[model samples]
Target: MKLSLAEQMREMDKKAIEHGIPDIVLMENASIKSFYQILDAYGDVSGSLAVCFVGAGNNGGDALAIARHLYNNYCDVFIYMLVPEEKLNPSPKTNFEIIKNMGIPYKFVENDDDFDIEVINEADLIIDGIFGTGLSRKVEGRFKKAIELINDSDAFVVSVDIPSGIKADSGEVMGIAVEADLTPTFALAKPGHFLYPGRIYAKDVRVVDISTPVSVIEEFDPSFVAIDSSQIKLTYRNPTSHKGDFGHLAVVGGSTGKSGAVIMASKAALKSGVGLVSAVIPASINTAFESHLLEAMSYPVDDNGGFFSENSIDSILEFVADKSAVCLGMGLGVTESTKKVVKAVMGIEKPMIIDADGLNCLSFFVDELKNRKAPTIITPHPKEFSRLCGVKTKEVLEKRLELIKEFATNYNCIVVLKMADTLIASPDGKIYINTTGNVGLATGGSGDVLSGMIGAFLAEGYEPLQAAINGVYLHGLAADIATESSISYESLMPSDVIENINKAILSFFEA
Candidate 1:
């Protein structure tokens, strides 16, 4: 589904209003849809006490209208107006008048001291509508206090649009944010709902249709997308197709002690349904690959002692010459010789997935990426990406979307920034946010498995962007399946994730 930024959503709303949908109608639609979501989550609300934390903006207007619906259904609804009724926005003022005329109980509070914490604690439900996607600054004063109170309460909370205090575009929590059990967003999901801390707060997001014209949404043409099984486009295998019809993939990276990295990667590629898989490793680690990888072919290159050296460059290039794609740099040590080999491989005219130590090596000559015409995908976690971009790790986390997009555009490559919520940026400026996977993927060698999965897809002739998206989604889905099948998160290893890849793919098709 298309994901909108705060500004884009506002523009959509503006265009929608200009297209004949009045602001009040939009508010009413949002309230009614949100009410239904509440009903689904909370069941019967006829005799329930619901505290609506109403602000002065359109978001608050949505809460005010919802209050009327609650009242109509026999809910003991009370409105806690953060701002005076006179201070409400035009549409919100209209809603306030309606609720006031209906004789609903309400209180205007100017500060934390005026709030009835005991009453809020006793309520069964809290409707958080104090802030919307337009919020960009830190929430303070009564708003902050209100959020703290709501979070402290045990009541089921529903936030309108997005949880209050989250920066709509970045998901950065400003001061504190409301911890809602459910979030009912309008039209499109926002970045804040899928990105980190905000995703944690937006536990369950239900997109509500507020009658925005399809033409208006199409005119905006949002570039951000949330990847799910529906977005996956996998070709059906022909009935008579042989193993060779799939594709050959080369897994290139392995040192003395880190041979398991390449082993897992090669196995993952095979599990992903590649026609053939090969591990190009140092001579010192050839025995480990030979023993661990029974199906994958291993090409042993001369090593300088136990690590990759310049002597292996020629042999490495020759072995990967016929491969469809290259999955590079898992456990490949960062040394001058390894750097030479990595730089040489960049000249090859094939799709490449660079990860782990491969990223460390590329950090030295990132400009080399700009010289390549082939599809190059760099999978880097925060620290690795920081090295490639010559920025601090904190900065990479803070401005990941902008930095990844700029880097991909400048280098003419695809970037998969790995985090709790992975982000895939294409050279054309489109960004895909992956919503699968769980904390179990935090283990070591997980990225190597992901690189191999992506390489297999690329070898199978999937577009570079789709290959990356599918690989990421399936990688996470596999981990999720593993954890659900009784594997504890703390004990979930990359090998376990690899073992579940088939199940993940089956689940995708079944869905």
Candidate 2:
């Protein structure tokens, strides 16, 4: 886990200073890295043109320093300091004087008259240095005008560290943020660079080492984790193992109108390497799985057509006898009888995943969830999570790490808080933000499939956290592979996701 985007920079700078790395040298290293990124992306710019937007703070220093490098490439560069000369700090003033001494064209934007929108528009690239990770307030006045002008320009824009006007810690846009075609960030990718408005604002992101030592990262202890393709590949199953050794998952859910929920989970379970999958649903679905699900065995539970009743508990218990894991929720209707059945199922001692309606049931039975001997996981998409937490959806979306840890500890189960960036939080406060899924996974029945995938990992012997981390990573990775047709999130369906699970899984074992 790395500290957040803002905190990461702060810690890096703090330690650099502590180790006696002068502020100017650190600024020089960062500026050169920024300079290198621009050259790498756009290639040699000898005899080219660039517009550098600088602020009065040290942020402006980075732009001034980079202006020197662009000059080295024989480019006509202009440094437009958005702040008045009187407002500039010592470090920025020192750099500004150096740029003037070097005879590089530069000026301060006193008003709209000094605003060189045309000069920037005519340039090959615009470098954003108006605000860095330290900005915590709303953008207004000339700063806003400068940002708008640079954005409207034809020049391919590149942001330093983070896109201006976006909060590095919370990833919220203060007012209006700069949209960059490429953002060269120092140290580690900021939370904003990866989160909602910032993620969208940061068109393309790259992290430069900047000499932020590994020892410093360990000291600060970051709450966030970046999931990579290489790590998922590391969790591969043994090729020599038999089918029975993989795992067995019992998927329980689906009603008349909701039959598709459990169906997707079963298909996902089988596709993710669970050898034995017995889907116990309303008797109506047995035929559905028989025709639609080739590999999954359907166990018919007597139902009143629309929901599961207490009567199925005996047979459901019997179905769970040899299964290594159980996945409940999905289309299981929120009926009185179904509630009782969910309660009865939770009391059984086996590894279980409570999802969809199952999560709703567990929210009412915290004591049962905590007392259970089995390793249990509860997967809740934002809306479903709102129901369990009894709070507004915004609260969860805004302060995800806090809300997830609170719920996971209270219920004594691993909580997978699903959204655009899904969070897997454990009772011990270990949180991992899933880096895989795209917007294409925002459709119905997606959570059900994810629930089954986690259970599949659990039955195969991964710990609760490992199961959750691996499951979420795998589910999103699968969706990324399935986007071959360039399907947008709105048009992507759960079935489309199921079709790619094998490809996603095999990618882990590929030579």
- Model 2 residue 310 CA deviation (Å) reads 0.8
Q: Which stretches of candidate 2 lie over 4 Å from their true place?
A: 1-5, 218-220, 233-239, 486-490
lDDT of each: 0.92, 0.81
Worst 10 residues of 2 by lDDT: 228-237
Task: Report model 1's TM-score to 2 decimal places.
Answer: 0.99
- Model 2 over residues 1-511: C-alpha lDDT tens digits? 3536565677678887898877787778878998898888988878788999999767678888888888988988988888878788777788888998899988778776788667878989888999988899999988888888987998888887788998887678989999998888777777777767677898778877667666775676666666655445335557798889888888888888787888788888877777788888988767766787788888889887568868888998888878888999889888887888899888778899999988777667656777888888888888778877888888878777788888788877898888887877777775666778888887777888898888888877677778888789989988888776676677888888888888888876774
Highest-TM-score candidate: 1
Candidate 2: residue pairs that collide: 2-222, 3-222, 5-190, 440-489
TM-score of each: 0.99, 0.93
What are the clashing pairs of model 1?
none
